[model samples]
Structures are given as structure tokens and as C-alpha cells.
Target: MSLKVLSALDVARIQLYHFKAIIIAGMGLFTDAYDLFCIPPIIKLIGRIYYVEEKQYRTTPTVVVSALVAIALLGTVVGQLVFGRLGDRIGRRSVYGLSLGIMVLSSIACGFSICRTRNCVLVSLGFFRFLLGVGIGGDYPLSATIMSEFANKKTRGAFIAAVFSMQGFGILVSSVVTMVVCKIFEATSHVSNGQIPEQVDIAWRLILMVGAIPAAMTYYWRMMMPETARYTALVEQNVLQAAMDMEKVLDIPMSQIAEDSLLPSYPPPSYPLLSKRFFRRHGYDLFSCAASWFLVDVVFYSSNLFQSQTYHRFIKDQPDVNAYELAFRVARFQAILAICSTIPGYWVTVYFIDRIGRVKIQMIGFFFMAMVYFAIGIPYKYFWSEKIGIGFITLYALTFFFCNFGPNTTTFIVPAELFPARFRSTCHGISGAVGKVGAIIGTVGFLWASRIPNNNGKPDPVRMTVALVFLGVVCLVGLAVTYFFTRETMGRSLEDNENDDE
Candidate 1:
């Protein structure tokens, strides 16, 4: 088999295998999003169960809240760097199932977060969450690289975007599941005077445990997938294996296979990531991807992972609500927001990503998010006020819509499409890891920043002004970066994306 044949197959029209690859890869993302986002509600339960008596359930100390939110991000940074490089060294199919397995086990363990002491419970939950993050992080580079390698050039962006769009569904499902579970516990448990019962703990545990289901379900199919043909041929230099595998995937007859003699004889490129050849050719591309993803996530994760906190701003004056009530209300509202805005935005991207071009959609999405978020920030006090709280919720929902439609989806799509096969997973991992770093900063920093004090030492009305303004600026910077550094990958062959000779 030859490089040209593989490239031709890559750009060929879509096939059944493309959808298979999407389902196989997309399920992992669904599990990833469900596991990652589900943590917030569970953390709310943790606050209610463990900290409510301290009069700080809803107002858990910033440090404690930050730890719960940021630990998984730390693990993901490590996982992306580790699994990504390992995928290149070994093979994608070989190590692919490991991440899902980890996610399953860790998610279950996270549900059993109980311990002999309160301190032990925190340690146990945090440790499992971190491990879960590692698994979810591994899926990022692997899923993107696999889907990009499998997709046809004509619709590669849409395919990969569709895979990522499962994230929107996953998030929506998490909200729905949380709502149903909360309602079930409420209906079944013996509640006196509206006090939350011990059965409430079971609800949180069940919610956390459910994340393992989808991941475990997909593990078999994931392992059954052959190594992506690009990795087999380009990185491993096993043209025969690559040809046979792709033959099955594309249903190409043996008669169509290229002869080994005609294949390129040059050795696979093996430069270190920091080598001059790599730096000169792909350095700017690498930095742009990492920085843009980082900037988008800073706002993205903060808004998403801490969404209940944002919702609290609208209904904070509700008097005498217990922690479980607050948790249920937050999950219900989050579900509504996701159904109405988040899921729609993701589907719109899936519909138009290939048509509009990646660069244009991203820039437009960022611009709209920046403007809306800025508008929300400028009148922070007014929106937080009871008279205009609905107005604030409307504006807040728009940011989520644009985020899914724009940088959030585009950032994930581009890294998989823009880099060489050998370094594709590694580069994507680095970009993803950097994005998680920003997520950590966003989540932890926003927790503290949103609590800025006024002259009287009470929290100020303009507290969100600084954070939203910073996010809006970051989106603008993302727009500029996308314009200058990222090329549109609407119809380009993955091989064409490489800067080096075959």
C-alpha cells in the first residue's frame, strides 16, 4: 500500500464505517461529558450532606469548592500528556479501552465516596474524581484523532463536530438524570417539615454511579476497533497492515490496493516536539491551538461546572430552602437551559460547520459570545436584581449557546485536523491539557472572584463584572487568534494538513 492510496481513502466520500466510528468514538465522549459534568451536582449533594450543618452548604468555602472542581482538571492534564504520547508509541486501539475502563471504575468509586471520617470522604471523593478526570482526559485526544483519521475530507469537520456534540447531549442527560433522581428520592423518602432525609445521599450516589454505565457499555466496541489506518501506515510503517485494515473499513477490494513497491520509502518523521524542524513548521500552529483552547475553556468550564452558582444569583433571595431543595432546583434549571440552548447550539454547529468553514463559525461565535457576555457584565447589578433576573438568565443562556456553536466545538475539531499523524494525538493532548489548565484557573479563580467584597465587606453587585469582562476579552482574543493562526479545515485532506513529506 502507498501513502497516496491512504490519502485517497481518507478524502473519499462518506461510508457506513464513518458512522460506526462516530458512534464508537462518540459514546466515549458522551460518557466523558456525563462523568465530568455530573460531578457538579454530586458536589452539591456533598455540600448538603457534609457542610449544610455548618451553615455553609450552599456557601461552601471557596478552597473546598475549588478543590472539588479543579482536582479532575489536574488529572486530565496528566492523562492527556501520558495517554497521548503512549498512543503514538504503542497504538490507538491498544490503549483506547484503558481510559474507558478507568472511567467506569473511578465513577463507581466516586459514588462510594463515603468514609469513616469526613476528611476521609473528601479524600476518597477527590481521589476518584481525579482518576475519573484522567480517563475523561484520555478520551479527548484519542477520540478526536480517531474520528478525524476515519472521516472523509468532505465532511470531516462535521463528523468530528458531531462526535463532540454528544457532549451537549451528555450534559443534557446529566441534568435530566439528576432531576429525576432527586424527584425519586423526594417522593420515596420520609421527609418531615421539608428536611432532607438520609435517602437523599443515595440519590447522589446513584447519580454518580450512573456515569459508569455508558462508558462500560462502549468498552467492547472501542477495543474491537482496529488501529486507525493513518497511525498504522505513517507512524508504525506497516503499510500492509494499514492497507488490510482500511480495506475492511472502506470495503475496498484487494484489487484496488496499491503495491508495496510504489509506496514512499522515506522513514517516518521522528523529531522531538521541540526540535527545530517541528518548531519552524508547526510551532505557531501548536501554540495557537493550545492558547485558543485554553482561553475558551477558561470561560467555558467556569460557566458550565459552576452553573448552579450562576443560577443561584437569580434565585438567591428565596428564603429557607434546604440544601437538597437547592440542588434539585439547580439541576432542573440547568436541564432547562441545556435543552433550550446548549443542545440546539451544538446541533446547529453539526448542521453548518462544514458549510460555513471552521474559521468563520468560530470567529462569529466568539464575537457573539463576547458581546452578550459583556452586555451581561456591564449591568451585572441590574441583572442580578429581582426585577430583571429573568433578563439575566436569558443573556446567560445565550453565552452557552454561542460557546457550543463556536470556540468550544471548533477548538476540539481543529487540533485533530491540523497536525501530522505521528504527532497528531500528542499535539492534541498538549492542547487539551493546556485547556484543562485554563479550566482549573477558570473554575477555581471564578469561585473566588465572584465573591469579591464591597466596602461594607458584603459581596458586591459588580463581582461578576470582572470575571465576565475577562471572559469576554478572552473570547475576543480567541477570535483574533483564530483569524491569524488557524486555517479552515472544511475540505482539506488530513495528509494535506501535514507540513512534512511522506
Candidate 2:
């Protein structure tokens, strides 16, 4: 029978299975958001809890606090690069399980927070934070690949972007849980007025414990999910199974699957990627992805960390808030706004990813981000210019709105799609790891910039210049990367990429 002859009923089954995969991938993305965000409120809580024992916990210097954050983001950098490659080599499903396991274990360990007589507390918290970051790094490429593979060409961008949109959901949930936990810890905290209390009090331990919520959710997927059919087919050469999986997704026929999947007796198309013709092509796909992802991540993290300070100032100044009330409100507001951004972002990526293509959206978003971020530096240089300051901040938020709708959504989606099967997971992982470098750069750099105040008690021009330059460079590079490099991979069959490998 011809490809056109498949029953409509068969196509429906295939669609249902693919839908399930996207949701499952979304769950993993949630963990990434939760792991990154769970730290901020705890930073506040820990400060209050151990103020008197400041030396004991090394809470004495702002630098020390900043150091902890840097280490964790750095951990994500390591995880993305390292674990990502591991996933490609071993198998996507196994790595997915392993990454989730590490995340769950580290989160629970963080709840046992400490760092007193010995290095136990610091060691424990830092170790777990790092491990969780790594898990997030690995998950980035893995989940994106899974969603894209299972998605229909018509809706691939939307489905994957929606999976990523769950990142915002994770942020919103972490904020809510932290808020609730902070309030409860406050009421029973045995301390009042946002003070840490003279005793080894309730703040940090309570704050860290909320991480368990995501840990709990990890078990939800233990039964319902499997490896992406595309990954299974491409890397493992399990054509029959791959075809079966696709049939479930596209609702096609068994005979149609067999006919469609027939391997050419002789190889046809080619990806210069795997050709021995290229120097060190064996790992180039993996490393190049890592490098590009790492570069993009730094910009993303820098903008997010810097922008968050809009509210961070309030937390720093308001010491009298109820512990729970304080954490909850900040998270709620941030999450709410971010979630609002995701709704539109999800719609755009899903609707236009195929139509407009990835490069165009990424170029436009990064360009706009460069202009807006530079504007932020202007008011920082002139501290008294509150009107311009507010305007810059608003523009920055608008940039994020555009950021998510555009580059933020596409970059993650594109890398997973670009590479062939054997290298796809590893390549994406490498890309993820590279992204982590960006995150580390952003985390460390912005943590310092957040403190940049001018001689007039306003933001220093030097600091603003540095921030403007940093973001400017990121957007500029992104523009170049998308323009001179990168290709479209929206509608091709995975089967086609495989035959090229031969």
C-alpha cells in the first residue's frame, strides 16, 4: 500500500503517544527550574538563621555568599558538558534516569543543611547544589531532544517550547513553596521581625528543605515514560521499534511503517558531521554544541541574575517582613510575571518555529536584547535618573518577554535537532555544558555587578559599561552564530538523517 493509504485511526494513536512524551519532558524541565531557583530564598533565610554564628557558617562576607552561588552555577556548567556527553554515549533514557536521580538525592541532602564544626554543612550544601546543577545541565539537552523527536512537524516548536515553558512553572512553584515554607518557619521560627534569632534558628534549614518537593515529583515519571523513539531508532538502529513508535505517534499503519523505514541497500544522503573527511569529526559535533551552548548560557544567566535584582533590592532592604510572607511574595510576583511571559512565548514558538525558522527568531531577539541591556547601563551611570532607570528596567522586562518568545525558546530547540543520532545526545549534552559556561560567567559576573554603585551613590558607569558590553557581546555573538552559521531542521524525517550517516 502507498504512504497515503494509512487509516486515520492509526495516525491518532501516534499523536497521543507523542503528546505524552512532551509532558514527560516538561516534568524534567521543572526540576531544572526548581534546582536553580531554590537557592535565593534560602540565602536570605540562612543569613538570618546564622547571623550570630556568622563565622561558623562563613556568612560574614557578601563575597562568601556570592561564592556559594558561583560554585553551584559552575556545577551546572560541568554537568551540562560532562553528563550531556554521557547521555549521548550510553543512552538518553538511562542518562535521564541518572540525572533525575542525582537531582533527587542532592535535593534531599540539602535539606540536611549544615557547615559548623567540620566542613559537613558547606561540603554537603555545596556538593548537592553542584550535583543538582549538573542534573539540570544534562536534562536541558535530553528533554529538548525527547520533545522535539516526538512532536509533529507542524507543532514541534510549540510542543518543545511548551515543555520549556514548564521551566517557568518550575520557577513559579519553587517561589510558592519557598514562600509557604518561609512563612511556616517564621511562625514557628521562635524569632520575629525577620531576624535570624540568636539561636541556631529556623531560616536556612527550612529554606533548603523545600527542594524536596521536586524530589518527590521525580517519582511521578518512574512508570509512564520511555526513551524518545527517534533516539532509539537513530542511535541504536532499532528501525522496527522506531517505526512502531512513530506509528503510535503519527497514527500510521504497520505495513506503512515497514515501507517507510526501508534502509537503502546503498547509502544516499550525507552529513559532513560524521565523515572521516573532517578533522576529529568523531567528537566535533559534541564539542561544537557544547561551545555554542556555553556561550549562549552566559548571556542568559547574566541577564536573568541582573534583572532579578530589581526585586532583590527590596529583599536586601526589608528586614522586618515575616519570613514566610517575604519569600512567598517575591517568588510569587516573579513567577507570575515569568509565567505570563511563557504563555506568549509558548504560543509563538509552537506557531512560528516551523514557518519562520529558528535563525530569524534568535537573531531578532538577541539584537533587541543588546539594545535594551545597553539602555540599562545608562541610568546606572546616572544614579539620580530614576525615570530613565525605571524606563530601562521596563525595557529589560520587555526584552525578557521577547527573549523567551524568541532565542530562549529556539536555541535549546535547534541544537537538539541539528545533530544526527549517534552524536545527537552527546552533541546536545556538549551544547548544554557549553551553555553552563555562560551560566557560570553570568552568575559570577552579575553577582559582582549587582554591587556596582557609583560615586554619587548611583550605579557606577564603569559597572554599567561592563554590563552593557557583556550583554552586547552576547547578543552580538548570537546574531553572528545564527547568521553565518546554523541551519534549518524543522521538517526532516529522522530516518533520512540516519541513511546519511551510512
| lDDT (0 to 1) per candidate | 0.79, 0.61
- Estimate candidate 1's RMSD in Å: 2.4
* Cα RMSDs, all models: 2.4, 4.4
TM-score of 1: 0.93
RMSD of 2: 4.4
* lDDT by residue (tens digit), candidate 1, 164-276: 98887788788778878877776677454336467767788889898788778878889889898788877887777777887777867655655546454436777777689
* lDDT for predicted candidate 2 compared with the true structure: 0.61
Model 2 alpha-carbon drift over 4 Å, by segment: 1-14, 52-62, 114-120, 188-191, 197-209, 212-224, 244-250, 259-292, 313-316, 319-325, 340-343, 383-390, 451-461, 495-502
Candidate 2 C-alpha lDDT tens digits along 148-247 = 6666555666677777877777777777777666666656656655554433334456555565565456556734466555555545656556666555
TM-score, every prediction: 0.93, 0.83
